[model samples]
Target chain A: MKKHETAGPTLLRQLTYRLAVFTLIFAILDVGLVVWTYTSQPEALGEQLLTLEASKLERSPFLSPDELTGPPGARSWSARAVYPARANPDHPNRSGSLMDWTRRERLEHSIRISGVRRIERGGSPEWVWMELEADSIRPYIPVILNELLTHVALPLVPLLALMLIFNVLAARRILQPLRQAEREIERLDAEKMTTRLTEPSAPREVNALVRAVNRALQRLDDTMVRLRSFTSNAAHELRTPLSIIQLSLERLPESDHRTELQLDVSQLNRLVGQMLDLTRADTMEFDTGTILDLADIGRDIVSDMTPMAYSANRELHFDDFGSAMVSGHAEAIYRIYRNLVDNAFLHAPGESPIEVSAGPGPQISVRDYGPGICEADLSNIFEPLWRKDRRRNDGAGLGLSIVKRLAEAHHGTVSVQNMNGSGALFTVHFQEGMPESGDLKQTLPS
Target chain B: MRLLLIEDSKRLASLIRDGLQDQGFAVDWCETLNEVKLLRQLVQYDLLLLDLGLPDGDGLSLVRSMRRREDTTPILIITAHGELDDRVVGLDAGADDYLCKPFQLPELVSRCRALLRRPGASLSTVLSAGNVLFDSSTRALLVSGNLVDATAREINLLEHLLRRTGQVVPRPVLENSLYSMENAVTPNALEASVSRLRKRLKMAAANVQIRTVHGVGYVLFEPK
Candidate 1:
């Protein structure tokens, strides 16, 4: 999808390109129409030229016809004859000889008889016969083209440019809603599954697409709801029986077998609890309004788990650097530290102290002085159900994964590294500052 | 001591009741919240072990109603819903403590005992860790059935540590308990008292020992 988006032209570029293309097409069609009209109606051009010549003759009535007609061999106009009213009273200009003579001359020289005109120049009636050489009009072509350009094409250039600018702006205006929808979609995630795109005032096609996307989001939210409820129900159903078994086991007489069974039951219990926690971390949304102190939570968890650590022949320590305030759910953050400590207890050497510290910043770290993680397993340590020794029943390997998910749900990051000497240190960095209110809604399964 | 246990599951309820009885508590087992209302009228229970999920209604409603009427019987919520939100809600509804299900019976008994040991609750005034015991009413210390002599400050520190056995008690808490707000205390005052108490316990041959968690606090545990 990213490749295609980069490869395709943007809406503004496409609109400008198409507008320029159509403008060129219209300009070409306009020029063609002007040329065709002039060529198809040559008589109109002849009539216009003849009227201009007659007007020039009227301004200078004393000029001889020989001066008006150019030399014979030149490509120019010629005055065939000038007839007075008295010379032919009834139809003076309808003389057969004159007509025949003009026709013969036109055929011989390929001359065009422009027109015949009657005029009373200097108070005397007269008829004039005019003819022009067809080839002589070639010099006038540039003038006609200049006129057409000045009258039509020149004005259209600015108009076309204005249209192009308007088209680009209009295209951007029409797509504004779609850009808004894009931003909303970009912000969508599993936590904000309830968010939907809304663009009622967009164009018909874009609105249709927005509605379709909203419907898809609704379906996804429904699926998430179903999944969360299923997880909750499964947890309740499994935990009840496990509780009964644990209780029943505690009633048995003390023996090696009983202790082994009890150990097995407790391990199973931890696995179930961790699995549920993993599921909740995946689906739960944090309430941004809940402000918690990281240092306080760390101290509380270390204090709470001290008894467990003591029974395991290990010591738990907590270090607080004033109060580290952040926006998060208390229990989820507690779970993260608790899981890290639990992991440390599982790996650290007996009686070695584990340290849990909360911070100079919005961060918490747990360090265990034990055989540090191997280089190969460092990357996969947080993966669910990944155990160093698969045969061992000590842990179900879900604790680290739960820690990672819960940390992420609070907008935090988790990392692990081996100490310089002999230990592994796990650190979680939480985002500081209050999250935007109403960004997410808590939707826990009933 | 008498206690009321509310749970819906019969087998689990019976196991819990037996476990509590073995711990020397007269346990009255009921399966619903309605039976609890009727039982409360007849006998005043020292502690209430209420399960959040019951047949009649949510146990939180009962906790809220009990606290509303000024009844402070020290309700301990036992539930399979172990999510943090549920625990917070339970506590906010006036429950004294929360214990998620699938827990060992020993843990349940310890939590019950802890709640019952609150100042107003009707229970023995004796708090013990391993072979060492501290009587809150008489301010007495006993080790292996022998009385041990200790100063008032040492006994005060001992009582606080014994109350949270096998748990880390922060230095500030111990200091605040040892010296009142008006009294000025030196930085090493708590360490001095702890060392003195440690010597007394060693002389008395008490099994429990106070171990310091560097940069944190101290914990009292029985060495294996």
Candidate 2:
């Protein structure tokens, strides 16, 4: 049984392999022809010797005929004269008779010569013929191979090389659209699901694949839009009822149950707001060209939450090293800080002040002095709706998730770690520097 | 003081109206922008409590059109969208302040009062936080209904701090309010004024205290 191949050889390698096989087959054929020619040389050489002697005798019979010898391997060649029918009656051979010489030469020398011609010299005519005898034609082998190499193999080498190069370039040209599609797919993410692979000029097979992938992406984008809108609409719809509940609770006489109910309603409100924020972070197309100071956002969050923090018998503080300019949506960055601080307030001891700091770079961090997060739960803390204590109604556990999403939407990162001594630290790092006009537009939704 | 409330939800609007009326204000409720336009012509409400989401249209356009007519009436936006972008947009569209939904009645009342307390608004000139009061017209300081000695600079600092009673007023904001920009003011001048005011308030046994928020700013809060 053949093993399944996960990956095949590259296109260029496949073409090279085929070209090598073709060159090998051509070489074998050329060599076989050379060998066959070398093996039959003696027969062809004897016929050529006889023909040469007859022609020489016809041209000049009285002159000493040139020595009849074949190529370098021939041992020797000898010519014999025969009488013309008019010159000698009752001669054993007829003039220009090939059959008579063939019979005579076959009986004398193991090889036969058959040409008989009458040549006139000084008003007299005579017949002449020649035969060649040789031991071997081995010496011509190198010559034959050299001729094949120079005329066929040598030129074929460069031609095959050129063909390999042309094949590789042509294959690359043919697959260029696929490479582009691969890059486009690599760039696709939840944010860019709407982007489609657009290469109409690709080959039919690749274009079919591209179209299929595009359809899948379109379906995914449609689902995502529906999900986001559902979340947003649900959050919006909950706000009115929550407001009525809160206002109704406010009007009730002071009681422990009413106070608890108010807290519950506020918690529900916060959850709904976070849900809306999460949806917006997923879909909001913000201008990356707007530059904001991280220090200022930090200050705003600190000031805004100070009253609440104070009422809870906890303190909120802001520390700024310098102006930390970053390019992002100001509201998103503000949310990152606000969520972190809110999370810290939930965990930190009342007396211990939560420290929020920004600057030295495009970074902001919130630190809380409390029992640090369990090592096991640190990784799952940023997941939405995940809670350490599932029964606790204080938080819906969406704050950290929203923080993570908002940070990522701005091309930033959110990280959490246990501090040195009984505390947790959450930090967010944003990409610094203003984006170019082109990049800003690219960040916008299509 | 009379206030007009424009909100889409009937129950929430009635609740807010009742809450505001309980806070000693004449509150009129409407559910659409068109009614707000009609009511504005018939009655001179001191404040407009606008909800961003109304039945007829977005309240933002109403706020924009009102400002276009150069109407100085203060508008406070009550919204369900509490994101900073919405707040900035509302304020940029000429709304004086923003309050998110599901807020405590006290918070809503405080925000409304803060907006009405602005210089040209119909609220009284005297601003009070805890047991301390400062008369902006007379530049007089009183602790527990008794007049207390305070310098001009101290009075200025107290007025700014009293405006945002429980909130942190950034140092730059206090400095700009206390001293003219053209004044070659010393670096510690505002701090010096704050320190003297704190001492005077302490001497007078004022219920309110000016607390420094480290490097950020100051907050005036009633001591427990």
Candidate 3:
């Protein structure tokens, strides 16, 4: 599996988002506490200062104003004294008595500050004004903010880093079985039906998937075994009777009738053989790594079939070009060449030479001088049971199909093309660098 | 020579048996593995033509069992299984040779003769190809029922080529079997012998001819 860079939103990214949200909530709570305490505390301090100053003035009504001007105790405090003056009816110079001064006079003359409070506590109930400096409350604001940073944000940043790291590790740990299951599935070769995916040591949901896949494979394997058996049995059942017929025919005396019987029997045998070859090509287990010389195989086949070609009045020749060593099953390669040569003999014109050649490219070509295939029939040449015309019907039409299938089994291709002047050319090309073995297993249906 | 044929198909067995008998082999046909097992204990045979799909048991198992008991009789498997693996497995299980089904009678006869040519194998005294016959017992060569004189070396070359009737006989094999190593081997020694043998056989009106398979060797066959 290819590793991809983290460029999008992944599990880890979403985890980081949740961590940021948690930090935001912590900030709101921390800052909200400081703001609430700062606004409410100054008003309570002003009221306490006013009460103490009023009681002091009641004890010493003649205390000098200078005595209360400087700072008092823990708070910066001061007091203000007021004398009531109202219009006199009888004597213009006389001042109104302290008791006679109505509540209206005190209410109109009162002064207000943010941290100041007024109180009336003398025997005559006179009003005293006390205030705390604004600078006194401003200092505590910076102290509270510093305390917040040290206690909350400072430690929280590292804790969040540790949490992020731990989350990623935990996520990978939880997904380990899933990755293992994927590897096991990837390694399973369909050709090797005995291999089964291992039970993932994961949660129950993941195990269920693995078990289901294994069951499906078991069913498929059973079906394959049955199909293989059927093919083998069918070949046996069909060929045995054909053998009996051919043997019985051979026991008769030689005559024109026997010759005809021989021809029909031979034809029947070829058809049966091709039919089985087709089945085997489709279903047989093939392996690689066996090295064989293509030219050597061609020479041997060409030599063996020389007599047949001679009787047909067609000369068969092998144009050897050193050793064309290829990696494939020897039997399979032999069959490919045998089929090509045999097809040429059956279809090529009499008295013409059929040349089988090998090359350095690991290619084998069989050229026959006969009526070249029609353009329309070329596309369907490799299809099973394809006969161009009744006049040319000499086979069951399974030969070329079998050739195509066998070539494909070796990871090769079979192609045919009409020659310029005459005849047809059939070539099989094997890919280079084929694995010695198990390459076919990799291609099996999974 | 005596031969045992284990085959389940009655018609195929009968035809093969008649053909073998005509070829001077005393053939006993058994339709099942049990019959073969019983008959082998009672008699000794020169050859066994076994079919793979027997009624009672697989012919491969029979071959394996016979081999385990140290029986070295040449086993020629006539089977419908002609796959490469099938051939390899059959040979590995102790079969001497294998012939796929739907084979010609002449090829089967030839293969049987070839197998019997091994050392210590009991073969028929009379060997014939085309119109020529060589009787080992009487040391006589007859063509068209008349005696034809031939030298010992020529007879050996002719016999070797005739046994493998249609297959090519390489020059070296023919030369090695015809001459001894102690003799100063001449380049044309085999050629001279083959030329004289060929002319004599032609003068004698033998039905077969020795044709050279160019660059390979010679193959003897009846001209059609």
Candidate 4:
């Protein structure tokens, strides 16, 4: 809710952080699965097969050949037991199974008998148990894995990689408009209040936020309207009575009553006029917008006040300003001018010439030779009713404050610094124009 | 010289008319813009002191419309709104000058006379602030209509001051005007001349002000 705070995290940084997190977590899980599988059942199963085969070979290694079952009496009592015919198997058998075997047969089979019988385990016999179990269970494990490596994982790796890349791309796509909106908000300018956020076609989550900001701006505009009304009203209210009193004084004779009264009234009127203008300027919109010739306003106020400057023994001079133009209410811009010139005249003590100049950047500076404002007070000197010294009563203490507000309205800024030794320099800055069509235009207040 | 006053209020118009008549300037007054326009078309008044507020139309717009018709008669704007911008606008609208309201009638008369006399040099003849008047052509000085013989230095300073009235002529510029580009003048001499002039100007006879602008220089105010 604080004014001028920046929205956090730009799109570029958000994308980078998200991609890194995804890659890191994926690598961890992939390694974890590999480690878990490598330490499981296969190696232990291989060793158990060797132990069981040794035990089976020690019991009844040769007797199982005569009848192949019933321990020479368990099978074939009808045909009588002779040499079990190898030719009946129609080529050498790998596992000599003839009938359904119970769990006991599988448990009782020995590794010693496995070598003597024509089990066909000559080539790569170390994996015989595994081979036997695997052969009996399923063939084509190598074939299936080879096909998976070539036809599945090979293509899937690239597909998954593309998905991850697209995730980062998608996130940026989704956030791009919002990020732009945030940046636009960050760049909201008081001088450019007429400028609003070009609300993006964004997620609905952010729609209300945009609406809220626009509403806030609407309120500000409404407040400014009322403030201007009050200012205009206040000026009239003060002007009427002052005018009446002046007229009444004028009707009096040319006696001491007229002279003394007129002198005091003159001073009083000057003070009141300055104060009212200050109040009006304090609340006026920053960019009511009119292009002004700075060269023009500077020329006028300087000439008008020159007589005062001359009487004080201080010279008033304007340095050349070439074709410098500004945009703002002409009156407001003049207020900026009056404050700087008045300050210069008040301080210079007729010793130094006030040198006012406009620069290449459409900027202007007023230099003086009076004792400069204190460094501590410089920051707040533009605040209303800010008087460094309590005793001086020439002004209502709003001159410089009006200067600051008027400058801001033009989308410009003003700064003051100490002159070489005993004076102050006030600088007003304006940016170059942005090619607004047509020649310069000025508007009068309705 | 007869002067025409355009004002909307009856009491204010009569008050101004009476006060101006007492000063010996023939004063004719009107209470509305239409009447003022009718009068302007007929009479050849030396000056027009126009009030900005009217019963019928804007006084400023009227001024602008008059200028559009090539009416170059001198105009002095009197208004209740005294913002600097207003003064600028009035002048830009072809007014010869502007005065914020509640003015001294003597001041107003004097201003009209000055504006009328501007084509010539009658205004420079007399400094009227304290009834001090110096006549260059006659080589005479008068305070409240009584002639007072002045030292030659005072006379010389008064003549120069009158010519550059209402402008701060720098001490250097004044010195240059006095001594010329080749006169090797001493600092003490200029100070002595200015000091004597200041003392005499402040004397009750003239209340003629020759103010020293601290470090800058000196200026004599334009007579009002």
TM-score of each: 0.81, 0.81, 0.65, 0.59
The C-alpha RMSD of each candidate to the native structure, in angstroms, is: 8.2, 8.9, 13.6, 12.0
**To one decimal place, how large is model 1's interface RMSD in Å?**
1.8
Looking at model 2, residue B51 earns an lDDT score of 87
Task: Choose the strongest candidate by DockQ.
Answer: 1
DockQ per candidate: 0.65, 0.64, 0.33, 0.21
Q: Tens digits of per-residue lDDT for model 2 on B46-65?
A: 99998888778899999899
lDDT of 1: 0.80
Please identify model 1 stretches exceeding 4 Å from their true place: A1-7, A13-25, A40-141, A144-148, A255-257, A374-379, A383-393, A433-446, B181-184, B222-224
The digit string of per-residue lDDT tens for model 1 on A194-234 reads 77887666598899999999998999999988987787788
What's the TM-score, to 2 decimals, of chain B in model 4?
Answer: 0.67
lDDT per residue as tens, model 4, B96-160 = 98987656665577567657655452234544444666666687877778877667766776666
lDDT of 3 at A65: 36
Candidate 4: CAPRI quality band: incorrect
Judged by TM-score relative to the true structure, which candidate is superior, 1 or 3? 1
lDDT of 4 by residue, A30-104 (tens): 545543443353343333332333233335444332332211212111112212234255646644443211121
Model 2 misplaced regions, further than 4 Å: A1-6, A19-159, A374-378, A433-446, B180-186, B222-224
* TM-score for chain A, prediction 2: 0.73
What TM-score does each model's chain B reach against the true chain B?
A: 0.94, 0.92, 0.84, 0.67
- Rank the candidate models, highest TM-score first: 1, 2, 3, 4
